[model samples]
Target: MALIGRILFVALFLGSGFAHITQAEAMGGYAASKGVPQAKLATFASGVLIVIGALMVLLGIWLDLGALLLVIFLLPTAFLMHAFWKETDPQAKQLEMIQFQKDLALAGGALLIFALYSGYGDNLGITITGPLF
Candidate 1:
């Protein structure tokens, strides 16, 4: 159950990170629409961070650092990209709010990971560094 949960947890970041890498242009355009400067670079950087962070946390190596990266990505993203307040349309606002809430939840999970295992990864028996394959 724990292994499954771990896989399910990192799956979100890995999937989205893959999309961000493959569809960087589209993602960057979306970021630009959200008023992010250097949108392309920002998008790419975020993709890398998400992938690396997810990998670290998933493998149980540097879990705290990985969670921190996700937190860094999540905060600004929740505020800027999913600015529900900026949406005037009721439906759109609802959608943005949902996204924002999801991001917030994910951030909370990241923080929890940090709280649970910030300094013990190297000595912990449950985690390994990097991918198993």
Candidate 2:
């Protein structure tokens, strides 16, 4: 069940990670609109981070660190990209709000995964490198 949960959790990031890279130019434009500095580079780098982090978590290799990486990615993204409070347009605000909430939830999930692995990793299931503290 834990293994299945891990897989289901990472499924969200796996495709998104690749999309971030492939759509860096487009994503960069969006990021730029959100005032992200060096948008293209940041987008590409984030893609790399997501890919590596998702893979690590999925494989149970240093799961805590991988989950931390996701948390790192998620928090800033939630604030920067989905600043719904700053949106004047009702529709835009609603959309951003949804995204913001979603990121926050995902971040929470990642944190929970981090805590689980950090505390009781060995008891979970199969892992390539286990949880490297």
Candidate 3:
């Protein structure tokens, strides 16, 4: 169940990260439209962060670090990209709100993982910082 959960959690980001590479120009344009500075560089950097973080989490390699990266990725992204309050149109606001909620939920999940890996509430004292078995 843990493995499955981890896999599902990383799936969207894994695809999205790769998509930035395959659809670089388009993604850069979208980022530019979003007022991101150095849109192309930001796009590629985001892709790298997303991929590395997702891979680390899914593979159980330095799970704490992975979770931290995820939090960093989702925080600004949620408030910036899914700025629901900034949308005046009802439908657009609703859509952005949903996206924002999802991002928050995902960030929560990452935080949970971070806490677990950080030895926040574990009696076992087992911390695996390498590849999953």
Query: In model 1, what lDDT does residue 75 have?
Result: 91
Better of 2 and 3 by lDDT: 2
Evaluated against the true structure, the overall lDDT of model 2 is: 0.93
For residues 1-133, write the lDDT of model 1, one tens digit per residue: 4445557888999999888888889999999999999998889889999999998888777777788889999999999999999999999999999999999999999887776665444444357763222
Local error of candidate 3 at residue 117 (angstroms): 1.8
Off by over 4 Å in 1: 119-125, 129-133
TM-score of each model, in listed order: 0.89, 0.97, 0.87
Each candidate: RMSD: 3.6, 0.8, 3.6
TM-score of 2: 0.97
Cα lDDT for residue 59, candidate 3:
76
Runs in model 3 deviating more than 4 A are: 120-133
Error of 1 at 91 (Å): 0.7
lDDT for 28 (candidate 2): 97
**Per-residue alpha-carbon lDDT of model 2 for 1-133, expressed as tens digits?**
8888989999989898998999999999999999999999999999999999999898989999999999999999999999999999999999999999999999999999999898998588777776877
| Residue 31 local lDDT, model 1 | 96
Q: With candidate 3 superimposed using the best TM-score fit, by how many Å does residue 20's alpha carbon deviate from the native?
A: 1.8
| Backbone clash numbers for all candidates listed | 0, 0, 0
lDDT of each: 0.83, 0.93, 0.81
Write out the backbone clash pairs for model 2: none
Pick by TM-score: 1 or 3, better one: 1
Order the candidates by lDDT, highest first: 2, 1, 3
